[model samples]
Target: MTQAQTGLPDVNAVGLGAPFGWLAGGWRDFTKAVGPCLIYGALLVAASLGLTAALYHAGAIRVLFVVAAGFMLVAPILAMGLYQTGRMLERGERPRVGDILFVKSAIRQDLFILGFALFLVYSVWVEMAHLVYGLSTHKFHKTLPEFVHFMLADPEGHNMVMTGTIIGGIIAFLAFSLVVVSAPMLLNTKSNVFVATLTSLRTVATNFLPMLLWGIMIVALTVLGIVTGFVGLIVTFPVIGLASWRAYRDLVPSSEGDVAAAAG
Candidate 1:
């Protein structure tokens, strides 16, 4: 019900099945430009694997789970390129791989502010994750084997997992509400971070059921990516990113039409 004072249109209320449409549109965009999309996905996969490997090598692999969770917190920024590709495709324009890199140049300030907000949120989640683990386990885990033992054999570890999941869920939900629409909206228009964020929250509030379903789908696919040795991300990440743009397209009204309606 909240309106954008800056003349942005009201949030569109989508059906429960709308997320699937977004996915289909995203798939089309991704496949139409497979080469560039794959490159983007591969970059993400490589970074994930590289960071995981570094953690394993450093004997701090137990912290890798937290690191993985942190990825979702900053995923909006990561998907900026895909949003660009989606917008380009929508406008019947072909996007090069380099377009993804240069897209941030236009909104450097807004992106920076959004990025800092995301980072701050992620930092809080990280600290909360640590606190959850500490409160639940009451001891340190030094290795993967130790971590596994604690989770499977220790009763306290079980409590930790439960508590962490609940807290992490709240954090993820808040992060989702904050940027689910704003990220793409930022790329598509000349709006400040606050306006975009407000629009995003409005979208989530107005379409809570569908947004919740979409959130569940995102998490399911992400888990699938991680389970497949991060190989699934080669497709999952880009598709999600592209699909997100479709989501934005549906949720936010077109600027031109909305402005015309306002004037008339």
Candidate 2:
């Protein structure tokens, strides 16, 4: 793979099942480093539970849906530890809980830039969700059951769901294209967020079908994690995180020679 004028290493084309292949690679890493990886996943589950409880107690039951979908926007950053675990494994080094938690490269400014950008996108998603929900219903449901009934029994809720899905999917896919490669690249390479994001965009643009399938699988698995009361996230999150690192490596240059040789 050659580094083009745009600074992106040539992206690889994979089969539609590439995402699953990544997940399988992730699972292998997870098993190899079960203790640290499971600990990391458990931490994510805790955070998920904490957020769901806080939102529920705050009587923002209407927003549970938003939170579930919006989780994708910030999940890349959250998956940093998983990426670290995968990276360490790739180097034939054993990873520990401490290594995953306090990764040295993760503290860089470029990652901060990416994180802030993700935060901005997440904020926009929240506001857009509010607007869509408000337009859909005048009444704010206070409980999960009430919200479920409103969505299932009312036409307004149905329209809102459809509209919100379309809008959210667009925003989420854009966010995914920006982060899917960049987040891991920033950690793995000396690249800045700009280059990282550009490469990420290029990867998706050049391989749209595979990228689309990857995005769908990510969202579907995330929804599955949320629906299972965050319990599923204990495994799903880590698997996705580890798998994401695999995806980044697959689509971009992993070694200095890979980029330099391509540049030549």
Instruction: Please report the candidate that would top TM-score against the real structure.
Output: 2
Model 2: per-residue Cα lDDT over 135-233, one tens digit each: 998897888899999889999989988998899989999999999999887775457789889889999998899999999998888888888988888
Q: What is the lDDT of residue 172 in candidate 2?
A: 96
Off by over 4 Å in 2: 1-4, 257-264
Q: Model 1, 201: alpha-carbon shift in Å?
A: 0.4
**Per-model TM against the reference:** 0.92, 0.93
Superposition-based RMSD of candidate 2 using all C-alpha atoms, in angstroms: 3.0
Runs in model 1 with CA error above 4 Å? Answer: 1-8, 104-107, 257-264
